[model samples]
Target: MKLTVTSSLLALALISSSADIGVHANTPFIIEKSPVDITLFVMSRCPDAIKCESTFSQVFQAEGLPEINPTLSYIGSIDETETSKTELDLSTTSTTTTTTVVTKVNCKHGPLECAGNTHQLCFREFFPDYKVWVPFVTTMNSWQPRRIGESAYAREVAERVLGLRQRRVRRFLSLEEEDAEEKKKELEVLLEKVDECSEGQRGFELLVKSVQNTLDHGVGTSCTVFIDNKKRCVVDGGVWRECPGGSTVADFVRSIKEAAGKVFRISW
Candidate 1:
């Protein structure tokens, strides 16, 4: 279906059990997730993506954040040798839980996206406590599609404002710049991407393929909203065609809550 956005927001609070931030692929953790997949794939510079990210921020702000189970892994692997996690005290009241399984948390916007995705991965690996990754991603997503700056520019902005550490941003940038004999290898060292050896050689070719695998399902079209793989449609031209009965912008959120019921939140 053609995903179109008018003005409503699909707020998603992903309260991942924070992962260690500094783990590398060579020394990666044995990450495992449930069979469910409630992933969101968008170009790093798309305005639609911003709507989803920022709108979720508004939702989280209004309803509050979800508390991570701590035992379950959000970004990193749950098979780590050490047991280290920040404790989050949450008032168990409202929760909006979707079918979030082993979803790929990635970006499709080019070099800026690559860096953004990896930076988020690193944050989950190193600094998973703050959970401001959504804000940071949304900050970069605000960039216009036609006009975008260099990777260094994104890195500087993230560090100066988004609070990403200088070194971590540099590492992601370095990964984005890696190449060998007319082949880009930046995706190889991305700490977050799942390592897939498709079509031989692990490079941008493979990473792109991995990212596309999920996006092919049609979430890449616009700020596509999915609650547990069920597409939520916002009324366009007075037609609510995506769901059983769609609603307008004001009723959009209400429909989600009414449909999803009891959404749980988790910051960082």
Candidate 2:
């Protein structure tokens, strides 16, 4: 899936989404003031990706942290030579729909890994709040080797995390306002919307764009960490190495705060 110079340009053309000067709607939203852009290149089914994301989750959840823009770029290979189109069909008991699209991207794990990647992307699209989707993805990464790529498992974990969030909000609600049955229905609806996106044409488009971005960045390895568009660290063979500043959570927090200070002339 290595991309030559010609194939790289072709891969960029496959993206149907708009490309603004410095704006990407599909990627995570960056805070305008003092934001540190952090992108993690990963594969959904890779064990190293799980370990890398889990470590960064700790960094993100650390108390009294500055504004940080976190994004995930899935790792895959795009082959421009393939001209044949593959149809993605998402069928249910009541209806069936097919997405006719040609994707040259090939994931390292398998087709299931591609589906899992799309599921995470859909979750990020449906729930933009990092607090919600980040933890949900981290939890899903925990359920690896067995339930990594199953659609049912994706829905199950989404409900589980969404319920946890709803309960936290429920604690602030008055007893009269708390309706458990109504909350259950709302959760079901939200899950259904995400499921549709993950199993439909939008999902395929998202994956293609993600893989295109990965290739554009020349990210060939899983668990590669990029901060401020520069390679900062990487997790390979389940271990962190080649970190210039340091790989510890404290080191990353310090680096981010330093970067923020330089960007905004304010200390954290």
Candidate 3:
């Protein structure tokens, strides 16, 4: 018989199927090896989002934590009614074709916010590892409101965090210039990928997909966290709110550990 896993009922069903009720001391133990899945929904320029991510940054910084894989999603709306199009025509052949293009996406915080969202999506795409991308995002969020979508600001932040600027400054003074140059090249390549992604149509597509996921999940809040496919917490005004399961770093750590689930087998 096949069983569908949901809540604690799966545990009950497993226990009832065991043949050796109390005869065996060593029973087959099952343990979940999968990492916890966490999804964060946020608007790039929202203060609430900043606070929420800052809290999560602390969670990540905690020592001796379980494996937690977090994904970032954006929240916004797209206006399909308002669009721009490109027309391609061959005058001699009397053939014409038109293609509709997405000019802009409407964000609650306005165009700069939209741009910020796109850049973040691009960053996540290129740097999927939470360790690499999370701090970069947190730094961006900590920046002033005026710098939210500025490419210059983003470039400078990337340089500072990735140590590209320091590498450049040391290239002239260091004894091992070749090593420094190689390191600079690697960082520069990744930064170039981010720039290309954020400035192209692919960035818009990623932003739209992220927004759609937020809409599909019916998440209207600026900062909402989902763990193991369930709503875990919300942070607004720099405080935890709407967290039924508790809202401390320890609370989140406990949830993540429990979310690993359990597995066992009958020993007859």
**Which candidate comes out best when scored by TM-score?**
3
Question: Residue by residue across 13-77, what tens digits does model 3's lDDT show?
Answer: 77876754454547555544667788889988988888888888888877777777888888888
Number of the candidate with higher lDDT, 1 or 3 = 3
Ranking by TM-score: 3, 2, 1
TM-score to native of every candidate shown: 0.41, 0.74, 0.75
Best-fitting candidate, scored by lDDT = 2
lDDT against the true structure, per candidate, is 0.39, 0.81, 0.79
- Write model 1 residue lDDT over 160-234, tens digit each, in one string: 443234334334434343333112223223222322221123433334453554345544354445543556642
Which scores better on TM-score, 2 or 3? 3
How many steric clashes does model 2 contain?
A: 0
Clashes of each: 15, 0, 1
Clashing residue pairs in candidate 3 are: 30-263
Give one digit per residue, the lDDT tens place, for model 2 in 1-268: 5558779877677553345523655455543556788899999999899989988899998887788889899999876552444444556335444454455668999888988899999989888888888988898987554687789889878877876444643543332345755665676787788999998998878988998999899988889998877899999998898899999998887877777766643222
Name model 1 segments beyond 4 Å from true: 1-38, 64-130, 143-149, 161-213, 216-218, 234-268
